[model samples]
Target: MGDEVKLFGMWASAFSRRVELALKLKGIQYEYIEEDLSNKSDLLLKNNPVHKKVPVLVHNGNSIAESLVILEYIDETWKVNPILPQDPYARAMARFWGRFIDEKVIGTLHRAIIFEGKEQEENIKEVHKELKLLENEVKGKDFFGGDTIGYVDIVAQVVAFWVELLQEIGGLELLTKDKFSFLYEWIGKLQNIEAVNECRPPREKHLEYIRALVENAKSGSK
Candidate 1:
């Protein structure tokens, strides 16, 4: 018998969307369990004992946490339309960029949007620098790994979506046309993909959520 697959996720999380995109891209049929972060399910807590995070992929009672790891697991297990390149060197490069964005860019963007004062300014500049580096890294490519949408593209799509939402929340336009032309164009291309379009939440809904989050952060409440 095939392994029973279930994904624990939050609808609005980029990490959750990353796994969802990977599953859809690979044409994997699985149950999607929407988790309330405020009241995380017992199964989720058990599956991901360390992080207690969403986007946990459980297969045949074996659970994997972290979006990037889950994406790789999905790609390797399904092996139909491959998300990562077959060549070892190319796959390494793809993994490198994915990790870089996860470690450097996303964190910077989060800090810039969620915090205020000097720390936020520092984070904004740091995120801008990272985007500049990415612009150079993806100079000639349609996607991060060239013409086709692959692992890097999947990672990028979620990040770009959150960045756009954060832009609205912060009421500032950091990713302007002149500053990062390549990323601007790339985000448009990613947004137009059918899978992306289907899974993405409405922009207004995201904005409303962010507004509430900002209010809560200000008041220091749960």
Candidate 2:
């Protein structure tokens, strides 16, 4: 029997983007189900009972949650274009960088939007520092792993678009080419790829969505 593949995701989710890119890279055909995060679907909650989060990949009636875990599953299921490296040590490095980007870079950037004054200033510093570490990693390569996109590339993709959008909308300067030269250039390279570009959320709509988040936070506090 053919596998029934479906993806539960939100348009503006960077985590969702990771799963989409992995499927695209492997040339897998699957249904894309967009979820309204505020009012999540029963399907989403049922599939991902633990976190009630997105980027859940349903294949042959089996559901996989969490973006990183889903990426590994996708790569293992369909090996046409490998997302991970073959060597055990090399694979370990790729996994390390992926976790680093999520824990350090993404969290710090979110903090920049959430906190203010002293807290925001600290977050901004941490973001720059984390980005600097990533910049050094990509100093002499086309991407995190190599010339082509891989697991680490997908994980680091938030910087490919999210950082730029946040900077424009929030009037914050982060991930500038002047500072993170290779890392900044790397974003443009990743964006230029047809697969990555196709899955990217439309900029105008995404801006509005993110702005609403900030506005809602402001209103809630007041």
Candidate 3:
């Protein structure tokens, strides 16, 4: 409710989107500062001195870094629309999956999309395996945290949006309704929520951006 809540982030970053989504879901009013990652702002550097990363949530002059950490901070600071469950084990499970999505799923998806030939193929296999484990974590619930789009859902913004576009750009069919049906249905459920949809970057724009990344990587290799 205070004008003190400020978010320093980039529009296209999945990590940044998670914090933004959490803020929106919590109904917390926060001022957003767009950081030019190539040339980071002094504000970002000053706030998150160690990492100098975007998606730093500065609340009441206190700075919190790392999107997943920020998500938990937002949930704790704002009582309403609890992003993490109250139950201790349930919260731990949600945090576990959120970390898994960030640490495992996203990295595998990135390599699978950007690499080629045997490397890409092998990475894709890993992506499938990792996704299946994540699907099992859902346990037939609409969202990882029961009916609400909570911690895990916010962390998985990449899978729900960017990865789908990345797959098409790479000419790979990774998470289809047929292969990763649970994840596919989960993506549909997450995207239907206004907070998630609004926070996610446009599919076409993200694809173009990723294609440019691949081209740059090729150029850098030469």
Candidate 4:
């Protein structure tokens, strides 16, 4: 086995897609293992005892968990078409924006779309604030990394995709052309990339899945 690489992932998970996109960008070959969240596989639990989450990278029998961590690992191991910037300051900036999207934007969107009542209102406001910051960050830049599709760009793209889905499900469009011109432009630029285009799931299918999840969540809460 010459550097056999395997990825355990769920089809709809943003985290899994992030890892998949990174691997494809770097031209790394890997086997894809689809895991069911309802009935997680034994191998997945064994590989990631702590989280038991998807997007686990298994390289030559060594397993790594967490999507962001796995992306860095793939970049380091492959070293071709570098994802993170080489410059220290630029790398820091990229990492900062990545974390911002993961923690602030995505986290808020999850709450706003899935939950109800006052909590949803608070989360919606928080998400709006985060989106404004992201819009400012993308001003005058083709990509989040400024003219290159790098780590920050990857994180931004993932967040944008899920945000669109959430907005559709919640019947509230937050990032429109008028409100977030820079972010709207940034998302268009990101979608034009061959790597991003190839890995994206169909919008109709994604929306249907989100609608079902939202309905299920509402029923559970009632």
Name the Cα RMSD for model 2.
1.4
- Distance from true position, residue 35, model 1, in Å? 0.4
- Cα lDDT over the full model 1: 0.84
Look at candidate 3 and give me any clashing residue pairs: none
RMSD of candidate 3 to the truth, in angstroms, is: 1.6
| Displacement of the residue 31 alpha carbon in candidate 3, Å | 0.4
Find the candidate with the highest TM-score and give its number.
Answer: 2
- lDDT-superior candidate, 3 or 4: 3
- Give the per-residue lDDT of model 4 (tens digit) for 1-222: 578999999888888888888988999898999999999999999999999889899999999998878888988899999999989998888788888888777767777887778988888888878889888888998887777788877777766687788787788766778888888888888888898877777889988987898889778877
What is the C-alpha lDDT profile of model 1 across 5-66, one tens digit per residue?
A: 99999887888888888888777788999999999989999999999988899998899999
Which regions of candidate 4 deviate over 4 angstroms? none
Question: How well is each residue in 90-170 modelled by candidate 3, as lDDT tens digits?
Answer: 989888888898888888887886677898899999998988898887759999889887888888777778877777777
Whole-model Cα lDDT per candidate?
Answer: 0.84, 0.88, 0.85, 0.84
> Could you tell which candidate, 2 or 4, scores higher by TM-score?
2
Candidate 1 colliding pairs: none
Error of 1 at 40 (Å): 1.0
List candidate 1 stretches off by more than 4 Å: 218-222
Q: Over 4 Å off in model 2, which ranges? A: 218-222
lDDT of 2 at 164: 87
- As a TM-score, model 1 comes out at 0.92
